[model samples]
Target: MICIRLFQWGIFVALSFVGCKSEPQNQDQKSIEKGIERIDVTEHYVSDSYHKRHDGFDWVAVSVKHHGDESLWVSVRSRADQKKPTCTYDTKAFRIDKNTYESTYDGKRIRFEFFPTSLTISTENPDDSNMLYFFCNGGATLAGHYGKIDGELDTQQIDLTTFSKVLNLQGIGFNVSSIEKDNKNTLTIFTFGLENRDYNETFTIEGQVVIDAEVEDLNSDGSPELFVYTQSVGSGSYGNIFAFSVNAKKSMSQVYFPPTSENPKINSGYRGHDAFTIVENTLSQRFPIYKEGDTNASPTGGTRQVSYTLVEGEAMRQLKVLDITEY
Candidate 1:
């Protein structure tokens, strides 16, 4: 029965990481109030050429090192690469035992478990049969994935918020659902079909809510594009940017650099604090612009640097700003 429900969800995630190591240490005092003293784990494997044109998929970079610096990073995907169905790993395949760590290649499998507060990743791929789950709580990053299609198995989840902490990219299929009341935010954008069985669309942003979301490919032509970031209640540091394009079907009706009542630049509505990137394949942003009665706690109107370029079969795959600098 699917390996007994994946061994009862791996023993309820190892007893919820042993009841979160009995709580109290508060994640080592929030990593010593951010002057982090320790937190290590590094493993990377990216067999280039942009993951061999997407479906051969293979990239894994989980380097969450702290005291030794280089704070956060997380990304995963593997269907076996590095030359034909070959997979590899060392360092005892990421040791760590009791706190969990596992590995398997060829048929693909990966796991890294650690919990006092959070950090998790689990993967599987019986040759694209799929299964994945990722978690991180230094602020937020959660994910889930499952697959099957025609025979039925599908599952998906994604929740993001990282305060610009960084989480890079990968295949990232869509499947987000959301709804918020008073603040008015609605988002339901699904789309599955490796065998066909899912489709949805509903994306609203009436008054803002939705701290962040990411998925990129930004015109790499390998599919993957959905970037949402919102904010607005009292509008302290104005923010809002939405970009969608999941190969099309009028999904979210295509929005990139939207928000216009005439001249709303800087990812749609300039203000302050904004930084997004998707290098090489292009899609960059940097914000901070105010001056018409400035306020964002004192901003005079200076930073701005946009750059986009996606332009696919019209109707809505348009994002061609190409450059707009100002230091």
Candidate 2:
């Protein structure tokens, strides 16, 4: 009886160990199956194997990342014989669906269609071949299908620093790019597809970094307004806004944004880390209010939200605070 009891205890221990090990294996298998069905926008891919080995065949490589919720930053490179690249393109692709994207470069509309395992670049109108010839050389074109790669791409193969976004509304488009140059930030704003507006401006920003941008028609006018938000590069993260309104659908004029320092009531207990967004036709700014004994990292006080309405000021159209709330 003692021997039988000892044998039963040993079998129980063995079974318990097997159950624990099999549970993790089952979970890992489930995770792999889930990954197979997942459509991750941020992926790296390369051309087919034939192009990679042959000298005459041109090879293309691409990498993509999420620019915003509705757009992707795509970087592409094509080369032959391991020599200088024949084509290089880096820009934003606005999403049309879950797996489709579109962009306009040099006045031509390019489409990017993604499948489960491959990506294809083409134009909506096959007759418009100028864009393909213009972006590539040596008879190599940026239009092709590519296969997905599993791991990280080589760092030297793609542009990782530059920030770009393309915003379009009504028939007008704005291509905004930002780069760090000479210890300061530089922004270039270019307007396209406008009949009477040739709005291309560059600004040198000091002590701040461009965070995000939005486009809206505030007053229900036919034309739209562009707002660029910036934040200081430090612990404070003080925010600023640069805005431009389309004038009668022909030209654009700068819209003034009031500084917080001038408004004593709103400026009290303000220590930056602000967030701005457009709710309907009104612009809203929200930040944490700090009490007298609060620290920069931790603010014990509640949040302060300021709502502004667009109005014609003495000098130009500016944002006038309509109400302020604390909660």
Candidate 3:
């Protein structure tokens, strides 16, 4: 009877060992199946060649098919080349988060956000922060930056073409008036609360008409100064630039330009097609100067380079002038 009992125990132990071994085998099979499923899903959404190929300027071509609409396509080039890293993504349904769009694929995620003049893409991995991309709207260049954060990818895109038109300059408590040109060769500027409320000023340019106007912070102050470039109606390509600064009271005041007598070496009037540039709190302009009888279209003179520095008392005074030289 004891011998019979030992034989039964041996059989039971062998069966238990086989059962434990088979259980692990089943688990291994399931794990393999799951890995295969992940690969299939990844392949369905992204090309097999792109997998693990995240490196410099990774270009992503997103092809989106919307219901009852023609297919939409967009190509994004990573900004990694610019030291701003970003992650790449296959086109997928996205959710809006505040001013951003969020999307995910293959266990990775991406986010896009927009600023007044730029768009940014971010990811969770710090290493991925170096990736960056370009987004062009209506052929206008929209600069981008990259960073990393934890959470669902968030993205926001703006029709930059429209942002410039509908942007609320008034919502920020600053009001600007349109530049008006009068028949008398006078340019009138009106603004409210830029320096003082209900401020109006008229600038007289003898024979020039206002052609372009832009606002820039030449002094790198929080407030931007206005720059108006004028062209001679009679002499094509001949132009002059005028700059205005906002006073403490928000009043638009003209920034000073040195008189010809003060700097006899540099040309008196501004000319050429290139606008002036402000760098390191200094404004500079280099352009060809036509002789008395020469129009910009038929220049027959030397070029003048002038530089100015922002001096105390809210003025831009000539800092240095180079002798006029042949172009």
Candidate 4:
């Protein structure tokens, strides 16, 4: 049964890479509620620590399964060769306590075991496990012993105080699930199990991208019309994205992103993750209106009506598209 669950998530990852998987996640499970799914979990986990790697500042991230309320998982990364110089590194780990015991990852001896490859803890105890899962540099950058990059915690008092007071998500485990580049300068924030739930975290978001929106041409001219976007976050317009038109007074009118079929179908009606801006990255799926002939377009981008000539000298009216990448 557990293997089935992992397989399900694994398949989810696969589908995400190749567009998406439409199957809704199991909503009855308690752990599933942590973030609704792995994407939300990883988004919340990475938060500000996530680097889009635009100019080469990338984070080596990894994750482990929950061992029945296990707490504290750590990540270790180094550029030096581990086998030659005896493999010592500046390792980072998450902290542990009673209330957050089930919410965090414990990184004890995370450095010693998975160097040059990967490591898995071998201990039977959930809290004080003595095993480290290790792997070598491969597709997922497998590292040998002491070479794993488990999610680390901010042990500093300031991070602790601010995280506790602001996010109210202290001790909750973090990891990078699926990262996608948005627009031309931002990254979409998706966490493990963030759907259907609202997280109030101490986040720094610049240039708001509205979700659950609509677009209409009020001038009777065929264009990407007035943009009406929204800022909700749950069922019944809670986590809604809004995109609409500018009214007569130059204010935003009520319109939104078309509900095309290409998006990952959520249990709720119409909602999506925040849009991110990134350079040379894929635009996330959001704020679109569903209509015939536009069903197969890439889910996200600044696509709008354009008149262009094809090679055959045929005039075609279509929406322009952008690039797509896993990030």
| Candidate 2 regions with alpha-carbon error over 4 angstroms | 1-157
| Stronger candidate by TM-score (2 vs 3) | 2
Model 1 C-alpha lDDT per residue in residues 153-181, reported as the tens digit of each score: 11111112112212223433454544554
Worst 10 residues of 2 by lDDT: 11-20
Would you estimate the TM-scores of all the predictions? Answer: 0.26, 0.59, 0.37, 0.19
Best by TM-score: 2
Candidate 2 achieves a global lDDT of 0.64
lDDT tens readout by residue for model 3, 101-179: 4433224445533232222445545454323221222221212232212221112210001000001122112222222
How would you order the candidates by TM-score, starting with the best?
A: 2, 3, 1, 4
lDDT of residue 46 for candidate 2: 63
In model 1, the Cα lDDT at residue 207 comes to: 60
For candidate 4, give the lDDT of residue 81: 17
- Cα lDDT tens digits, model 4, 1-327, are 000000010100000000011122234432333332221111112211223323322223233332223222222222111121111111112213221222112323332122122222222243343222222122222222112223443221001110000011122211111111232212122112232332222222234322211223323332223221233323222222222222332222233332432434321222232232111111233332323343333333332221111111123222223323221
Tell me which of candidates 1 and 4 scores higher on lDDT: 1
